[model samples]
Target: MDGRSLWRGAVAAGITLALGIGNASASFLVPQTALPGKNVPKYRDPLPTFAGSRVPATSGYTVSFEEFKQQVLPASGGFGPTTVWGYKINGNGPLWPGYTVEATKGSPATATYVNNLAGPGGTPPLLQKYLTVDQTIHWADPFKLRCMFTPMAAGCFDPYTGPVPAVAHLHGGEDKSDFDGGPEQWFTPNGMRGPAYRTYTSAGAPPAPANGAVYNYPNGQEATTLWFHDHALGTTRLNVYGGLAAFYFLRDDRDTGRADNPIRLPAGDQETEILIQDRQFDTAGQLLFPDGFPSGLNGAPPNPTVHPFWIPEFFGDVIVVNGKSWPYQNVEPRRYRLRLLNGSNARFYNLAFIDGVLRSAPIWQIGTDGGLLDAPVPIVYPGRLLLAPGERADVIVDFTPFAGKTVTLTNNAKAPFPSGMAADPQTTAQIMQFRVGTTVTGDTDGTCDPAASKKSGNKCVLRTTPMVKLATAKGTTAPGVTVATRRQLVLREIEGGGGPLEVLLNNTKWSGIMESTMGTTNTPVAGSTQLVDYWLTELPTLGSTEVWEIINTTGDAHPIHLHLVQFQIMNRQPYQANKYLSDWMAALTAAGKGPGDGPPNPYATVLTDTLSIGGQNQVIGGNLLVTPYLQGSPVPAAPNEQGWKDTVVMMPGEVTRIAVRFSPQGNPIGGSVGYSFDATDGPGYVWHCHILDHEDNEMMRPYIPVKP
Candidate 1:
């Protein structure tokens, strides 16, 4: 990658900015998932495992999701690979409650994490956990992401902060808006104890960070992997950088039937999950900031402090697996089904295993955040497997021949990122480890034939749906439906005179509570909140098709997504990309837009649901057609997202258009509707941008169902 392209692709995300950020209020701008394995052993998981390998050594408290708080440091670390601060890390305990990481098939999971981070200029003992998601102002996701706890540039600390107010969300999960983790649920360390933390339109309030009490997940969707992150009002970038992220694998015990019923995979551990992420550290082993920061984006006001902490999109220097940086896993020489996730904040990875190349690329793709693919598609070559921030890929790899030999599963994606930050050898050139085994044992873990899979080709058949799947398991969209409703969702951003800083779904501030209208125009009322209705009413129940438009009103490119199912990327139009580096020159550079003049080089992307939408420009375009594999759904069933997903991305300047199915997973549209309804709490489903920061800052709305 050339220096120029490197800089172009990769730029700093969360700097304070110099031109306008000086006095800019970087308020809440944010958005923010479990498993089981079979073995004859029936291995039981204990509490410490959930703390992660290093849980015992670090922090020291084995708190549940409710007891953790974001941290604030008096000093900052200098530039290097970006650093991370875990969101709900716990200290040790003899047998603490809910501190253990438990993975199982066909079971429900819940979390009650909290944050006690102090606002800028806060002192120690700032932690305040125990907040639950059930109590929030017109909110959906009650969990919060603690940004105030995030570390700033080298040696910088904003002791006097407005609030560490947080709202967390699992980017993609087949849950409803409630469990989907939206910003409306934001709260301060104090639940009702804090200001304006409940969901009421008339509630006047000051800023406050929600404690661990605000956030929760009802992992009831499919058995796909999901992630968690901060979703504060305006400080999303800062919060996530402060180290609030992790993975949750929802295990499916029931079979979804993708594996070959009569065939066989060449075999080893029936299935595997691969975790990948990047980080930056300062010279003092802290996270690094790109050059020309303090001011987040171009011509923006500079932050009062000058440390270079990482931004919202975190594609770190080293690869992280499980939780260790560049850690290698010893494998036995057999075909292993591997699930991969690009857990980088901003970086995109094009993955390829360096074994004897792939034969038809093997049946690599199996399941996604929601559920397993209908069937495995043979990989032809290593093209782009784009991973947006907070996105994931559940895939597989065969190590049949490379068993005794060490094969490197490496990444060739350039760093500083192509659209975000530049990469250095120290940061970009590092390799993610996937070491082959030195030994192999048949029937593995000391067992002979422990219930061999009935299917061939695939290791594990998805026995059941993931929790997120259950979240949206209600109804189906009547097929062949036309346009009953058409609403326009635009992603917009403002600079110069001081508008919202980072991403925005539509044009709304992160509603600490409810407002005149929370979501968009066509939203429906559910329980006591508003929801986004992504259905085209005029279309038919089985083969309905409608035109949906997603307007990108921002200057930078963004990747827009639709939950519930996958669509075909129709086309894209180009606009200018944000030029942060060139704009820094004393004189305006060629590509640099003077203040308010739009951006340069904006281009449209015809996507397949997994492409990056370039940020900012005059305009851009993208489209998709929702085609349900199965027919008929009730309660707005988008079963495809059930493997897991609540929101997706619609890149900057692009109006992503597509048709979506409300229901259609298990049975026909009529058969599924209102069959298994849960009105007590809800499976109130929704969809939004995967770029959580944008969603939290009122970029997200809601999706509700008005049953027949």
Candidate 2:
């Protein structure tokens, strides 16, 4: 059967596949057996690399999304090319995990992104045949289907086969809100636009076309490894899964991407990027995604009554890195810098290198999602590098010790994070291989050598120049900075009879009455701690510092990411989740807010009723503070997480605290300073769970910065 026929057959049979889900029904599922990951030769394909302009340029960089054929599974596996949608840079052939774009600090760089996913004469692309767009979720709604307005509405459960909507979001970028590429700022190739769509043009630059967006990045922050990907509403998981992501490296004088620089870190050919993701393929060598099928490993959607095709989480059996499955890189026995990014939709990786039976090498962590750390963190055996979805880690590994030996990179982290199913030994557990060459060339160990580092006055003496420390110590605030406010936020899940209907951040929806009531009038409700109106909750004064305590009431761990600014991880403490949730429900009941209370609003999608606990002044309701229910003293951040970070891991039953300053990372504490660009304008920014599945739901919130 052809690819389209196989997709239709799979959907019609409601067949599910594996990756911790139950086994598929052999009689009904289209593909009786998938290509076993072990059947594909390890280290068969060489890792691919691409780099952008090092010097600053304004208008030369252009990236577009187009459909192409790629060898995802090797030809030896008896599979043909897989059709995918990938980024084509500067009119070149499209590539998955597109080329890396480099920029210098304090200078500006601009790029134009075009949406070309439509086929001949503007028809739906062929890749759509494999995707089952869940219209029940709040999405771009390019055709204005408004499926989310009513449960099981007509066409709500059908796959979307129209022009694809896309917008480029530079993760961890400190740019203006217009260039943030928020969920509502998406645009399609067929002249369809989202509600908050707006293109930014720099001074002396041309205006953007109707099908594209021009964005300027004022590289004012410290040097860090940032990435760009699609952020279209609801369908982010689908868009990114179809290959639409690239790297953006911001550099400064201190940490230049050169060997001769002061840092003397690994550079040029010695440095490489390793992006890890999970995927599943069909018998025709085509990408396969679960569409809430009832049989096989995928099983049925947890809450099929509410959402027909939307699953809580997705886990693939095969691991792919740099566009190839089970690929390897031949490296000399010398130190190399590996910029690791976890781009999976939901899986978390506890990565480590093993040679034979023993651990191979110690990983020296130098930077995180934001920028370089104060000192290198030595990660030895038993302590693997844990990276959740959308998180990045900059580390150095010296292969000098294991000359001529083969080292295997492995992952032990479970699916669904903290407490989920273990990785399959033959497939997801093994990431890639490194065949270390016996001959060591250019094996110079500079200041970046971990052995040369020692403790000095509460800091490591690895660098001649000092990095601006975000805090005196983990969980402690930066010295002399006065906090403006302290807020308690909640991560909650609304469940149905089958499973999770939707996960919410602060018990609110993406759009509707709850969001509209924020930053407006105020009135106290009778005999309740809840108020009729509350000032904007997350809107912080530009350049002001605040402490946000995130209370996770769910059973799983979540990777919470904040856009625009990188903050310091304060600490995490255990709490009585059940007690806190009971009290929270009581507060909502007292305030006359139930699951489906109040009158319906035609304008609202998910929050038509007064079901929200509302934003701002969360402590007012029955003094719902996490401090009283704390189970123990706070634990400081891990050694690897002592630096500035834009994304953090929030564990279950714990209150994770973070100190956020609504300004650039280099800004001095205690001073009110804003970015060079206007961050207060446009559609603002959002903080959400990096799990694309949860993010597509309501597990995201928008925050704007206002001038003090």
Candidate 3:
């Protein structure tokens, strides 16, 4: 790296100091549009605009804003278990309560969301009004200028619909702040206001907070299939379990661009949205969960540990999809586009669809929560998809190769993916039916996968974008901090009673304040009004790479995620299992221990959004070529996250390594070794684990490059 000053950088801090860890009360928002003047939905085939377009025909079963509570919902039923449970990311890593969402060409677009939360010793309910909370929801696939009305207390929880607080985030959207769902940008069941508070004041923080919290999103980005759900306070997991969630289909070329897709649109049964998730059924088919704090929370209170089961994570005993339990869908001789989301609290899935039983290679990976990648990568076909909580992926599976044959979408990625969590025998045999018909959907087009599924993380997508090509940064240099500057982040586990629930960054729990305590528990909120603590070290303008070694001292696996950039896995080693047990548990646990290990010197593996770091060697390495976004600045976007990005995950015990540039384009901030991005009140970006629960619970930190 050459040409610039010896230390250029910017600091954008404020996100780490403003997050809430209290129990949540969030739910769905009100409608944003009026119903058609006529009884039926007044949608245009080519009516007003989009006359001759071929986007998903938005003409079927659209319930207008007015007819919400009266005609549609009560008739549609409230909440229940998912149809199938699979993976979105893969392995025994982070998983989600899984299920399927289907949007056909002509059939009524419908989705059956499942609540996989378990309660009172892991039993589920077969009855109504699932929990003790009062919550309800209404969703729109697209963001309109209006809000939807919801009777929070009246639906499932008690007091039936009150003015419950709420908001909607089309996970993937092209909308406005008024429409982009932010934690702060929320309203109550009684229609209190719009996006009132961005951050929630957590318990145990120093008294006298300055302001309420609120969040805002960049709604103007292109659309990818997203969803609307509750994100208020700490109880996000519970509210979603109450059945206050829905699927979203942002209006975009992805839908209309179906023609160009290697996987054909649904002409028949060959295609369907395979929403895989896990859930527990009470004696009455009702969703269940025990109250109080999950294990491992930083500043969780001492008393009130009610509720049992419904642990931080859930893995099911059955598979469901599109309202059918291990049900089979008829498929034509064609390929299909499967958009997968991991809707769960804390579970990781390693998905692969099989040609026969649970034994086929993966097809390919074309998209992620962000959007489609240029090329496709191959994986072991789980005949299913993998996803972590709040994670999603867009895939294309070709049935043309296996035309006229009966196949099964089976899963072998055992629980605690990354292969750790033990599975109950009955729960491990989950499978779904995929019968192929002689009929082809359309021209069963070309495919990019002879192999692919959710594993080795990033493949199908090209690591280098056009930006990298232009800068002429052909061969690569390892990423690093300024030669004289280095930073180390420690992954810790805060233990108390039951098994540890989650891991934390830097020993801090998702509680407290950054300026005062600077403890592990204190993490700032994401987007809008989160004042945070950050450090931007300085160096040369011709920026030099720095070494960032992340150490983990926790028991459970953690996907230490960072936002805004992607890096290469430099090297990794497994920590000694024996030492881990001794440090993490009682004497009984120490009886059976094993030798710890680390990646061989300069260990190099695959490139992925996440890196799993076990106890061995206990060291994870990373480097960043200070790529600056400033024009005329030395760092370029070539090796930076040229594609639109804001988040990436690091798996547990994997000791993953990566190379990152400060600027999405070049190296070094300005002519210095450090620099920052321009901060606007709105687009002020932050990063954290893609695991929504982790982000909510505080495992997120913020940073901004600054000029000295």
Candidate 4:
């Protein structure tokens, strides 16, 4: 066979890395098969931010999501060019890392998102024929797919692979309920929309443009790191994997780039962002993703004959940064602020820097998924900072001492997280390299003075105004009013036929009944609530405070994420895994009740919206038995993580408690104690595991904050 056909066969066989047998760059190092995306003009600039306002200078530009051709993978790395879909501005190439949108606090912005992707709508998605899309499992079925069996089994729907659906969700923004971009609000390019979909009708907003959903973002919260990406139900994994995620920065007067700004962080070229993700490539030089696992490590589909494309987790063999695989960056000798976002589908990252001489750099963390920390935390090299999916780390790397040397940013985090497989050297181990230039930038030249800030003595001091602590608002401790309520919820994963079927919150599907204050008006449209559905339980009073203890009983760590409001992480405490789970499961099976019957331990401190649940260790036996093997002491939020946050890691075998305040409280940071609009109106919100695969299959639930 010819070289092209041979490579195609190799990809079909899942040969992850391209071979460098014939060429010799380094003895064992694999060679590049294609040119780097960075080499293309206009590919490396800080993505143009869409400030969708009328401020002529900063008003955002309208963009559309379309299927276009761009060189995703390099041709030199034993791979050719790749055709991928992405958001394009001014009809440009759908840039791989996508685009960024900036919003200022209090200055609202509006944009109409248009979906122009091509066909597969009548039949199955084109991707399904190339990759995997298990139609048997519960998923978005705009075409009403069904199996072709003579005797159709109960609860079986044939896989419907068709035209793609698209929607944009601002991950950590406090916006009106309708603009929240919940899964059920998906829309196709032809204007076919999900049941819960709504247009941007925030009071006096302008009419939506033809054939698109208009989104109005009220950037009324504090300045922090938020991201925008496709959040369509069921197809989120495929859409994101197809390349549609980017950063969204909410700025304020305090975070101004001027040298006189009180909180001087890095700005201009000195401030950089690295979006780290993983992917697999086919031999034909296209993106390769499987729909199922042959060994069934991911349990069989709930209905084997129908949904065949779903899998438990997806781990890619190639690491991508800013749209290039194993690319390099040239850095001058100075302190540079770096924002690291773990955008992988399911892989976690433990990142650190190593030089050619094996020496590591002094790293300091300044921010997180939400925003900047009060004080800088020294990140000792080799003690790599761990970042789970959907998490962010705002850090500074001082490269003055390592001038003229090549330093490599490395990853040691295991896949599937905490207890999963260790990283393979050729793929996940090494992320990217930095070539430090010998020419030194002036010592105190940058906007942020790292040397002075290091000695500020208040490195541990939080400078933001003091907002009401969850404890104070909940009345559980001194100096606060009584709490509005307290609730204990459980996160569970259900197994079918010994193979994993799906995950659920409170052991209930999305279609499960939720006590809606709106009465029958909240009902989902007929037929839309099928195998995969969500329940709007945990409805909190609009202006009250409540503490929720999330008990995770599964073996895998889940990054629990909540929508609309930002919460604080109270604390995590160890519990008798087998004991707590046994009683909990009994109650769930017998009475459909939660912690009221049996619950895990409770520990209570800080606030966050996303927290990672620690995965428990299990041994192979008649049934999966949880052993306290990997359950160590409870892990608390780091000092740098104590501030306001949207996402935090929840350890397994531990009960993670969080205090959530529905109304805003004016504190030192800058906002007031209430929402600018009626938060309880419209389609409502949801909470789910941020891992794309788990979220797509199950592991998610809807929640409505009630009116007091």
Which candidate leads the pack in lDDT? Answer: 2
Task: Give candidate 3 regions above 4 Å deviation.
Answer: 1-163, 170-185, 191-228, 243-256, 260-272, 292-310, 318-325, 355-361, 381-386, 423-425, 428-431, 441-487, 514-550, 560-649, 657-697, 700-708
Model 2 lDDT per residue over 511-566, tens place: 52242232243221222121111112366778877777789989999999999989
> Which candidate ranks first by TM-score, i.e. highest?
2
Question: The CA-based lDDT of model 4 is what?
Answer: 0.61
lDDT of 3 by residue, 19-134 (tens): 13223211111101111112111111110111122123133211110000111111123323322111121121112221112233213222111222222333322211232231
The model with the greater TM-score, 3 or 4, is 4
Q: How displaced is residue 248 in candidate 2, in Å?
A: 0.9
Give the TM-score ranking, best first. Answer: 2, 4, 1, 3
Candidate 4 lDDT tens digits, 8-88: 343333323323222111101122232223333221222222223111113544557766565555555445556666766
**Candidate 4 minimal-lDDT segment of 10 residues:** 615-624
What's model 3's lDDT at 80?
33
Lowest lDDT 10-residue stretch of candidate 1? 31-40
Quote each prediction's TM-score.
0.57, 0.88, 0.54, 0.79
By descending lDDT, how would the candidates be arranged? 2, 4, 1, 3
Residue 294 in candidate 1 has what lDDT? 32
